[model samples]
Target: MATKEFDELALDGTNYPIRASNIKINFASRGILNTIEEPNDGDPEIEPRKLNTALFLLRLYIHKDLKHEYMLETSPLNLWKALKERYDQQKELIWPEANYEWVHLRLQDFKTMAEYNHAVHNICSKLKFCEQEPTEAKKIEKTLSTMLPEDRILTQQYRTNNFQKHSLLIHTLTQAERHHELSLKNAQQRPPGSAPLPEVHFNVQNNAKNKKGFKGNSSNNPKNLTGKRKRNNNRRKFKDRKKGKGKDKAPQPRSNGNKHCNMCGSDTHVAKDCRIPKHLVLLYQKSLKDKKSSENPRFEAHFNLTHEERLEVASSHQAPVELESNINVLPEDVAPLSAMDDMFIEYCSTDPLGDLQ
Candidate 1:
């Protein structure tokens, strides 16, 4: 019975000369060895057709120069033998030391496991053709040694377990590569020590509503009500002082131009009508008192004067106090005052009487 028909080999010239020659030899060994050795005179068509097919495939692989040189040969066996001789001669001419070095250097430089495996297999195949085939253990050892640092450990472990099967080793390494890629992806997805902060959005409408509610509750707040009463009482005391001064001396002609408030540095208002903070107003008043005491040391010496005498001096020489434009009263200046001082100032501001009884 005829043997099973093997698939016809298709060769491309780019394949290594050794690989192409091996394939051609395998094709001949399959069923055609006898037909190539002893020609059948009975069936002229069958033998020639098989030989021609082999010759056609061989022609497809060789370079144009080699094709022109070998195409004149009529016998398929002769043509195949001639091609083998040419490739063998070429292989013999190549330096074994150079080939060994080339293979060793490139085996280590492969970026991926698949590339490394393919290169190792191809080099081994070439070495086998040259009758220098390395053992499986040596191949495995070489592959593990040449791998990158991270991959070397896993490859070494597989080798230690005596997993000398090339296919199985490649599969395990491929799986490891996939796991490494997944780990890297996960690490990149969420950076270390970096979590998103919860956002707090402010609602302008709610703030406005709260402000309205505060204004509505102002009358109910004891501090606000007391402050309003104190302001009104102060205004009445000021008006009373002005009336008393008017009675003593005829008022001088008031300027028609707008008055600039020395306290607030505003042209729209006078100093008396200035809305300067209570703390700043008290500080300004203290400064004025200090200046007057310095200019007239006699006034400070007469501190034991009767209440009526002090009032007389205060009303007669009421000098217009001017605040410096550059004076800035920050919250920190008033913050240092003791509770007792704050209470006394609050009491003095609320009191209807301007001075000590």
Candidate 2:
């Protein structure tokens, strides 16, 4: 199992060397295999009934971390071989098939660590391996067999047997392996006190000591309890009072005549009259007075204009004409000849030339 031999084996494309140095070795002179205490989970370190419980946990761990099925279509022998090859350097060796079979049968229907441990206890009873002496294997078997297969074996009460060993070991191992290394790199790395590792940090501020975030403020002070209750009662009372007042003030039926016009359509002038200009109103009044006066007999003289007078008035507005120089009339001839000549001309015009003589 030299490193060179392992390298050669790697060159040959075999996953594992024939004699890997890391494989578990039996240091005990008697050649009997050793059993290291299974890493104590914080649960009460109940004595294991069968070794397979540890193997189950280990297998589960490997499967989850490796993200692959441990023994898909693979025989139990192959699993044992692989386990021995990889982790044989560890203190506990996975037992041969006969012991494995005995352990596996007990664990087939195990639901919790307690049930599994009890099964281990049953096997230990038959095998007589544990320090706490086995008394009643038959009784345990009878009870377990008769119990419904679907029965939940774990309870909240037994959730953590709170093994001191597990707690201390986890703290030591995690700190030594992880936190310590991190602390060396980061000066502020403080190992978690003793709180259980949370799946998620739900409490943004971890004030578990004061219950600051875990419970509301009202829960802490008992004196404020009655006051809060009173406030809530007052709120309800106010709402009830409002509802009662609303009922009292319920709407009454409306009357028709009492309603007022929306516009200036009452005894007062309408919107058109209200908006009419003052000057326009004055003009309308004057026009009405004129119309009334025109219908009266007293205004007749004022109304009539005689024909000549009307003509004189009409001619006064006509465009003036200029007379030519040869058409000038003599004053005496034009003046006296006007009336008489008109008469003589009217008389003689009836007789032709004889009337003229």
Best by TM-score: 1
lDDT of 2 by residue, 34-121 (tens): 2233344574533443334333333432324332546461332344455545544322222232245453464336554355455654
Candidate 1 residue pairs in clash (backbone atoms < 3 Å): none
lDDT of 1 at 347: 36
lDDT of 1 by residue, 121-147 (tens): 766666666667778767666666667
Clashes of each: 0, 9
Candidate 1 TM-score over all chains jointly? 0.42
TM per model?
Answer: 0.42, 0.14
Task: Report the poorest 10 consecutive residues by lDDT, candidate 2.
Answer: 2-11
Error of 2 at 344 (Å): 40
What global local distance difference test value does model 2 have? 0.42
